[model samples]
Target: MADLPELPATITVDLDTPLKRGDDAIATLTFRRPTTVVLLDMSLIQLGLVDMDVMRDLLTRTSTVGLIGEEVDKIDGADMLQIARDVSDFFQIEEFEDLEIHIDGDIVTIPLVKPIVRGETTLDELRLRRPDSGSFRSLSLARIGQMETRSLAGLLPRISMSPLTEADTYAAEPGKQRGSLHAFLVASICTLARPGAIVDINVAPDRQQWWPGSPLIDLNPHGRTQNKKHRALVPVLPALDRWLRAEYATYIALSQQDRAGRGWLVNYHGRPIQDVDRAWDTMLTNLELPKGREWRSYLLRHSLATLARNRGATKWDLEGFMGHSDGSQTEVYAIGEFPSVVTALEGIVADMERLAPGAMHRSRTEHGLVGQLSKGDENVS
Candidate 1:
């Protein structure tokens, strides 16, 4: 085993398998300190860093020159494992040396940065403010169990002096506070998809499973792309449609190789975005969320499902829209497009708009997104 590198360290590794980026065949990767939360969503530290998926995720988050999932996948197996081992060494070598946790009754505080306070009464910390049972005034048992957004949104404004206003307590802060692309990603997940399903979407005019003309997105479950039979038609509500148009226009303009390449809809320099952990973390930071309140993009899926159900969408409707029924017999024997899916999605979008006015607005025009209208496509309204 090699010695662990020092804090804020750098290490370069020659890749056994080079990646193709335009005319360049990149053959090396230099990793740097993972500047953000290394594993915010990982609850069981006991699982360790040996897992390939976890290591791949960490590598993407920490890479100095930046790497997309596709690029990371091309890394040699031996090299990848060694990189993971190096990461484990760098992060876990000195376990208790620089660790700190403070608990005060219901509040648990963790300060990532030093507080610069010139005056009196300055405490540098981020703490959780737990709400007592009294916080659930008019909220019913059923609504709470269902995780209804509207009810929870209504309740959150009362919990803090500074209530979260984006989607009540559900979403991050307003789109204006963060870049429009960030807001677009958040809103897209909350309204139309599981994060991976949308993030991996390919929008090349000829290659995509569906197009702007289609009201439904034929989402291939992220890791199961090889299984062609398994796909779900997720509804594109009005708000989601606007976002798709904007993103599509931007994607085309940037990747003039429109007829070639994978055509990943959400990309960095035309490369597919395989994971969004870093983006999610960045959004949370912009929101100034308390340290302990880290959120995953998957939660937006939950919010959409619960919000739709609360607004009277049937289980089948949600199942169809969310790809929950993908591998089941429903996909083969009796899988017809469900009108209720559209209705349910529309309800969720309406609720989002009503709860936080203009929360779903397209703010990415400056990024060259055209938000184009369809040319009388039968599938789109």
Candidate 2:
């Protein structure tokens, strides 16, 4: 057996500003463990070095025997694990014989045996394998179960709701020329739901006509493609349909004067029209759904993709519907090619229209709003 590297006497700790309470500061500590170094490097890459600085400070300050409580509030579990691996690596330790982590509310106590590293390859294997037996495995299993339950719970509400009413369906129709634009938006989102494909939208041109007076949706404000400024819409077709229809009705009701001053739709005097974000929020809130922002975005795209998948659409078909490039690489490697993507979208839209014909109806009937007061007390006076 190869001898292990010597353990460092003290480890470096870092703390964030928010955790800088007088006596109790939250800190993260990283030691010289090989496994830890590997994990920390990955985390640093993911979070960026700038973000890791505060964490590094907190860890260094808390490593002392008596100062752990004084220098830290609550150690981050992920950070601590990464630090432990780093410490193991630095000391050339291998095979974590006995390591125990106990969590009680905000407090966590980790007791680990010193590792003895053999060679680089052996050390790599040790880091990848399970640290010990029993408790860790059981705890991990329990955590997985809890996460699965939470995910299932999040999906339940949306699945159980009944289809929208006919009157509501008809209220979403844009004029003849704009109908295709709405379809394109819905189709693009459906395309994204497939396994792997990049989607981009050119909103500037559309925004000019669709939102004349509104601020331009800038694509390159920071000169970085990865920045949030260039985020493209890949809305789930069903959700987009639901959202767009609602917005159209709300906008039309509030905007009274149509293109030719033809009072075609019933006007709501004083009711605030639904903006994009507000419309999405209202729909999710009404359904009492709980999903993180990113997951919600994925769900929106997934909803459309799922529809396309169900219709037996070719992947290439779906891609075309989404306005994606139909290059050879895309045809061979992309999950949702044009054919499949388009069919799924068309099928979903047709199903939704069939089930909820009123979804496209924008006209407000007297029966739809019996006692609801008009905006600005217009009906009251």
Candidate 3:
């Protein structure tokens, strides 16, 4: 990367203040395997060192898709099956055949569910259902008799997707371009916290618990994306609160002002975003790189966990961050550790809120994202 002038010259800047803390925190990362350069703050600063550059590369992107295809250069069959299982579990599919995968844009959904679910993915059969309902997978939900996500991966008989548009079908490249801000928005959210799903969320003006939420989108009433364990908001930084308020304000304004009355926070042509995957799909399709390049939807999630671990997050902190609810049924273990976990996660979450230093370039005006928020523009283009 240093060989090319297209990359900015970071060597001149002195990143002292945060680097000092990072240097001190390096001790915390000793337990991490392979002894990777653990940047306490992975923000951009040209430290004028070969190691920093390598570390930045390591911290920013981690492969979520581990399998490599033999010929077409897609995810390997095993990896694809693994992902298929994740998708199925996250969406609460009774059978693998129930999944309705689509790529008209970068989206995956399940039309079989009530209200038709969509979001990013994860989980197992025991982990599939809500905590209040039952702890693990049960035969009541069986289409194939108490099947697990992994078991069906190799033998899923049914999966479907929304029909493609005639124009998309005919055109060589029908997907549209998306702004970098959108990429940062999604990446930052997933990077900062456990993401149940990456689907669209409805944040209320005052906030209230709502229902029938997508598991991937935080199985909650108000439906704001939340931590799996604490149920606190993901992207748990102060800046997230500010930006989210801005988003909610824009949504309220748009819904109130629209002549056609579309009540979507994000929309296309006076319509609600029926399938939230459009935004996700657009972001990926717009990347100007080789198809099936290094990044994938789940990379942000993996990157966050790995980076957090590198920065000294303990196992309990990780459990809180990841929303792992599978411990002993008693409340004693979590209740005792919750406070410490929250404190440790606070710093890691803050680091995630800040975009990977130098990876994103913005003065905030290129896309008029701020302008759209300030003016309450409905289109987040």
Candidate 4:
């Protein structure tokens, strides 16, 4: 291990909204580096902010002023995510090396090139066949060696036949069946388990609610749709309508009992899936991505937001679609209330499809979008 930094590293955060605990209202939170015992038990960097419950638990255990669970729960979503990021940064070690390239027969091997740390794995290499004329489809020669993570994620899967499949991700046993559906679900919707639950099957003629995302944080066990404030009908475009129609047919075929009380259109052994961390890792392992490349559902949100903004979405349109509060008392009145949000989303998805084909559907292309968003894939969640 690299040398440890000074003990008790602290991050002082001023909250946009003060949370009340008993007689005291907390306006700022001071987070100290978790104890060695806490770090040993919890992999904050691996878990990151994707798991809000874990972050909350860690904060309660490490706060210098001692916040109760209620106060921690009341913390703003953006602030909480930022704190988790700051905490995770403490675990990063300074490590770098020059990229290595070699040629062997028909394949080219590049090792230890731009190593990245994600969870416990550090991906640092990539092996690919020597590119031919066909490999240059829609890509220039200059872009080949300078491919970003999303490009690599989308490109490599086409070249490689992943061991994991959409069905295998929901297999019954560990050593038995495994697939990429879990990863796909998370990547597609930015939420865990409860697949198809967020979709509105009862489509209206004037408007089609095609929203398939939840809040950046999901701690509700009952489901993410528990809060009425978070519910809104977004207009559906042609592409979204096509995707929804396909999913709707399958959704209606399942018996209510098969939904596992979660109304999940997707399930494993007729049971609702509670988590996908293991399945996500399995999917990553199948992708054969180089070590250190972190994959999280949060990246999907980042991609959508970035693309939507680039497509000229207003801040309210983004805030509405993303289910984020702007610290306005009237923010609750506008969730999914913007008709333009859907238009922005439609454009965003189109941009995604153009950038990374087959992201929306399996038949569309051989490529997958596990990492095929813009450079916004960086951990800003």
Candidate 5:
């Protein structure tokens, strides 16, 4: 009333349709007050660009916000987030938690929290998340390309989900044949999900059907229930074969003892391993995870499956490779075709070689791979 003009009661902005990035962007917002309706013209950073200076200017309650920047319109995500944050802060609209900040592209809306009721003020857990990498970006073709670029050594530290079950911890006894068998089990688990999913040494007597040198390993012969039991020659790399052979050697040695054992693989000292949980824990510990971090046994499978999906693995390929049963009244087996899974796994192996050189090193010291292979936890690398 003394010397200043009255501010607008309401403001409505008109940004160009289909917000894009560029330099020659011009935007206007109309401010309507009881006295008069004023038009405020502002230069926009091109292609839907927004910057800090622009944000600051817009926040000001004066006509000076219409000034154009002397520099090029180089707006980015940081700028946009800052502006959104400022707007939210200024508005302080806590009741309507509909505000979201993201770089628009190939968008996916996951149902994270469901509302309690349809329209009433009932609310659910408020959560916000954005995709860092994946098909969420329009230009990104291979969403899993991020994972495929990582080395086994590098991926080791990133695995957050640890052993989920208490029963998975205390697996077996420290037998004489423990070391070699442990190596065999560790190698097996790393290659696929559950040991039985790949090759239930206990169930499949005819596991070595794909020849000695071939990378493919067919664990399930012909059954509707067993690990989706089909024979499509799932690709098992040389690294896996090396471990399999080591395991077989132990199993064969144990066979000579004429002792009935549960595991198909034996130890270097000609003894059978009794516990799966023990072997899993011992192996993960050697992987050098943070002390006391529960190492999930199914992590390798998850990694394999995730990478495979990222590389465009089909449901058929995934189902076959994972031996997933559809829970049908009578088990129905899809034609065993796992080409995509194999391809994805190959790429993963190649990436591992590039990222972590000598991630898998097998050596024969004076003690050989015995006693060392006993506790089931060795430097599996």
Candidate 6:
């Protein structure tokens, strides 16, 4: 963290060449290190243009290079050495020797000296000192213009799937009311008699029927809706029935207070029974959710479409079930516009009946006779 040393006002350049009176020789001297500024001072004896006092003053003034002085002050010793090496490489100079540096706090002192052999100077050693200047380079206009026409090519289609698992259907301490609701919805869809048929549900009607005066009915009258027109075309496995019923039971039990309190799951003081976000967080912490809502919705729709396709359902039939508008663009332009809960539940029931003839009947019988009566136990500590 030490500050960089400052450059001296001038520098002395030693050359192997001797100069005649009034004869000007430009010596191109290379630096042993990287510096922002380079100073070159002519020897008084060689130039024969000034006295020793002037020459001594010039040498003292040229002792430090100003260009890299600031940078050196800010950087550590290791970085300074590295920068020096880099600068040396840029100059492409070999056999540079007799490098000496003196530092007194922030001030740098450099003394330039050359060997004298029999009072004769070698001309080959004479050179002007030039510091390598680094500056920012801007891109040309032509390159920027060319970039405008560049287009992305060959985008890969992304597909995703999210199947409801046993853990979702039967969590020991159900996380959120929404989670239970979602579980119930998925379960109900699975229980439909038609394995490959589209199931639709309207949240409004279903909520009204399930809990007539609940505040939730007013909040979201539409029952759980589905994209029936977009067929997933996947086969409805038999295991879906049990899963759906379990989810349904859990959802009903959790929302039972809301049902009794005229459709609002909140307490009399209007405080929420549980935080929805916290519930969702719990689910996220325990389960792997689809990346985003669009992806999840697509996965659900795709599953239905795939199932329908496998069941010998025509494109039009699939589209109708999915509530898509009729046209050539049905596959691309058309998406589920109206998701009806009643229609969906009916379809699900029918499918369930087809898959397991006695399952729905037994569930109704058990739920009506015993399930409803024991529901109170759920809210007990």
Cα lDDT tens digits, model 5, 1-381, are 012233334554443432232554535433222110111222222102434554444544322234333311333445445434534332333434453433223222222122334222332322122222321222322323322222222232222112211111222223332444344433443345464443343311334433334455655544534434332345666656555545543344444335344234324343434445565555445433333422354444665566556555677777766656443443344344467666655554444433333333233212344444443533321
Between candidates 3 and 6, name the one with more favorable lDDT.
Answer: 3
Whole-model Cα lDDT per candidate?
0.54, 0.34, 0.32, 0.44, 0.39, 0.31
lDDT of 6 by residue, 248-352 (tens): 343444444553333222112222233233443455445544335532322444544553343334555555444452234553564332233223333434443
Pick the winner on lDDT between candidates 2 and 4: 4
Residue runs of model 1 more than 4 Å from their true location after superposition = 1-192, 221-231, 251-259, 290-294, 336-341, 366-373, 376-381
- Which 10 residues in a row give candidate 5 its minimum summed lDDT? 160-169
- The lDDT ranking, best first, is 1, 4, 5, 2, 3, 6
Best by lDDT: 1
TM-score of each: 0.47, 0.28, 0.34, 0.36, 0.41, 0.25
Question: Model 3 over residues 69-148: C-alpha lDDT tens digits?
Answer: 22112323453333333322322324444344433222233232222121332111111111111111231334223232
Candidate 6 lDDT score at position 262: 30
Tell me the lDDT of model 2 at 316: 47
- The local lDDT score (0 to 100) that residue 266 gets in candidate 3 is 30
Residue-wise lDDT of candidate 2 within 1-381, one digit each (tens)? 334344565565453332444675545433432233223322332222333444344344434433344343345555554554454344342444444455433223333344324322111111111112211322343433443333323222222112222112322554422232232234334335221122222112222211212222221113334332223223234334333333333334443343222211112232222222333344445443443564343345555544344345555454444434333454346433244444445444444444445443322323222222122111211
* Candidate 5 residue spans exceeding 4 A from truth: 1-191, 195-199, 202-211, 221-233, 249-270, 282-295, 325-337, 361-381
Candidate 1 vs candidate 3: which has greater TM-score? 1
Return the number of clashes found in candidate 4: 12
- As for lDDT, the candidate ahead, 3 or 5, is 5
Q: Is candidate 4 or candidate 5 better by TM-score?
A: 5
